[model samples]
Target: MSLMSDIIAKAKARRMRIALPEGSDERTLRAARILTDGQIAEIILLGQPDKLNAQAKTLGFTLDGIEIVEPVTSAAYETYVDEYVQLRQHKGMTRKEALEVMKDTVFFAAMMVRNGIAHGAVSGAANTTAHVMRAGIQCVGVAEGFKTVSSFFMMILPEFRGEHHVPYFFADAALVPNPDASQLADIAIATADNWKALVGTDPNVAMLSFSTKGSATHPDVDKVIEATQLIHARRPDLNVDGELQFDAAVIPSIGERKSPGSPVAGHANVLIFPDLDAGNIAYKITQRFGKAEAIGPFVQGLNRSFNDLSRGCSTEDIVNTVAVAAVISQAQA
Candidate 1:
């Protein structure tokens, strides 16, 4: 099955609760209907109930059993604000300021995940990436014992061979512009763990570079090499190698010719780019020229599930992103 189909199936099997913070948005409301009708998730919309209903009617949609909730009016609203005050007390936030911030749908949805009221949240349709991420970091925080928060794009390519073409995941493409050695290592580890959970495959991590092994030398190549060493030292059980060129990382002929005897070379299903410039450019090229289907820009490394969607996303994109967040919840479970 295609990655998205597999993702939908996985999400339905999990039957998690997904919080939609932008219920007033036509696309999100519609996506919630699809998720609810398909029985994939228990859809909870954060908005004014009456306005949500009226908006749905105007859009020719029937909300049916879908639930609409306004964050400011919720019984848990005060509790959330108090918690936020404590969470950000170091910032010198006042109760009054906290209350106003809590009213934001992004913060509300993230608090829901923090409180276990929802398994995950999907937002950023009507918000910027910065705002959504700030809410998540302040409320949900990063996964336990991890320092960096990164992202990945699940790239499903056309069959490479008969039966060996599993989907590939590209990492740090949409977040963390220029990572140092330690941060890069954290991203690789997070990507590997995420892949094992959502993709259901043993992760073979490839830390990408323009030079294979020590064939060439540059500061950028050194960073990948250092990240590789860090990952190997920290996670000995994970199969990974780095400072490898693109051709050596995926193609057997090139891999054997250059970096033979490496476990991950030519067999990598998860690729970690050296920096955002390379990763963002490479994934776009793959999507456009290679005709690969890119399924995510999922924010990874959160303790609970919360994701930022592209403001340019469609209703279908929102649906897929919700499924991705649900899948992340399943991994935690």
Candidate 2:
């Protein structure tokens, strides 16, 4: 099955609790309605209950059976506050100072997930990327053994001329602008983990550069090679290889000729670029010129589930991101 189909299957098999912070937005309201009514999961919308309901009515969105929580007035507020205090105790801040920092809607939403009130938290469509990451790191506290929060873009390409191409996911475009070898290794591992969860396939990770098995030479290409080795050292069980060009990564013939014995050669489902410039450009080209429908810029590796928007996001973008967040929440659960 295709990756997206596999994702849909996984989501259907398990109902994941997705906490939508800033639930008053039109897109969030619509997603909440769809998720709840479609039996996707329990969507806990974080905001004032009355305001959410009133906005739902105004937007003509039905939010049947979707849970609503206002951290300010929730019966569980004290629990969240206490957790926040504990997490921030090392900062030399008093309880009041900590409370002030955690007052942001995203922070509270993440607290809900951290404390097991929800499975995962989704924000950043209405907030900045840095803010969402900070809240997640402080609250959910990264997955076991994951030191950094990396991210990726999942592209659902459109069917063209009666043939549908497989969905492709690319990594670390929106967050880390220029990743070093170690950071690239983190990106590879995180992307692999996300691929396993969202796509339910043991992903073959390919570290891509302009060079292919020493066929070309560049400092950046060396970085990809080093990153590939680091990822192997860290996660030997993962199928990965690098210092390959894009064609070598995906085309069996080229890959065989270039990197004959590499595990991910010509079979990589997850492509990790050497830097942000390549990742951002490749996905956009695939979307705009290649006519692919892009799903994310889904932020991964955070302590909790928090995604970012392009600041140019549409309603469909919002819907897909929420679905991605739901998948992540389910996987972690």
Candidate 3:
């Protein structure tokens, strides 16, 4: 099966609950129908029930089996507000502030994930990345031992080195502009874990740079080298190599010539770019010129499975993201 199909199948089998905060969005409502019909997950959509129902009807569908919660009127609203205040009181958050924040669907959906009302949450369509991520971090918080919350794009290549349809991961493309060595290492570790969870395989991680194994030198190269060492020091079990150029990381002949005998060279499925400038540009180029299917800028390193979408995402994109969130929820559980 294709990677997305496999993930969707897994989601169907697990039948985990995923909350969608953009219930008023037409694309989300359509995707909810698809998720419910496919049994991918038990979908809880947060919005006004009457408006959502009317929208579904106008769109020629019925949300019969789906659970819709109006955030402020929800039975768990007061409880969620109390929990939010407790969780954020250290930052001087008051009950009144918590009440207002909980009224926002995105925050409410994230709280649902935090409180176990839903196994995971997906938002950001019709909302900015900053807003979606803020809700996730504030409500769900970062996972223990992870100091950074990053994002990755699951790049499904149409063809790679004569193989058809290979899956690779590109990290920090949608978050973290210029990461220090430590944050870069954290991104590598998090992406590697995500690859294992979703692809069911050990990740061959390549920390990408302009230089390959001392072929060149610069501060940027030094940063990548340091990040590689940190990954080795912290996660020695991971098959990771670094300071490699793009070609050396993926092309077997170039890899052998540039970084001979490196386990990750040429076989790297998880590509950690030196910074977001490289990662963001590379993923777009791959998507456009390489004709690869870029599935995410999915958030990682959160305690609970909360994902963000592009504001311009399609209904299919929402469905795929929900599938990914569901699978991640299973892995976390």
- TM-score of every prediction relative to native: 0.97, 0.91, 0.97
- Go through the candidates in order and give the C-alpha RMSD of each one to the true structure: 1.3, 2.3, 1.2
Better of 1 and 2 by lDDT: 1
In candidate 1, where is summed lDDT lowest over 10 consecutive residues?
157-166
Pairs in clash, predicted candidate 1: none
lDDT of each: 0.90, 0.79, 0.93
Q: Write the per-residue lDDT of candidate 1 for residues 1-333, one digit (tens) a residue.
A: 767788789999978989999998999999999999998888999999999999999988789988777998899999999999999999999999999999999899999999999999999989999999999999999888689999999988776756533599999999999999999999999999888878887999999999999999999899999999999899999999988899899998888889989998888889999999999999999989978888789998889889999899999999998888888898886
Task: Kindly report which residue stretches of model 2 are placed more than 4 angstroms away from their true locations once superposed.
Answer: 1-6, 159-163
List model 2 lDDT by residue over 1-333, tens digit each: 765556656666787777888787777788778777766667888888888888899887656688888777777677777878887779865777766765677888888878787777777668877787888887888777666677788876666325476766799777788999888999999999888888777999889988888888878888988998898888999998888788888888888988898888887889998888888889889889988877777877776676666556666666666667778877676
TM-score of 1: 0.97
Error of 1 at 229 (Å): 1.5
lDDT tens digits, residues 171-206, model 3?
Answer: 989899999999999999999998998999999999
Q: How many backbone clashes does candidate 1 have?
A: 0
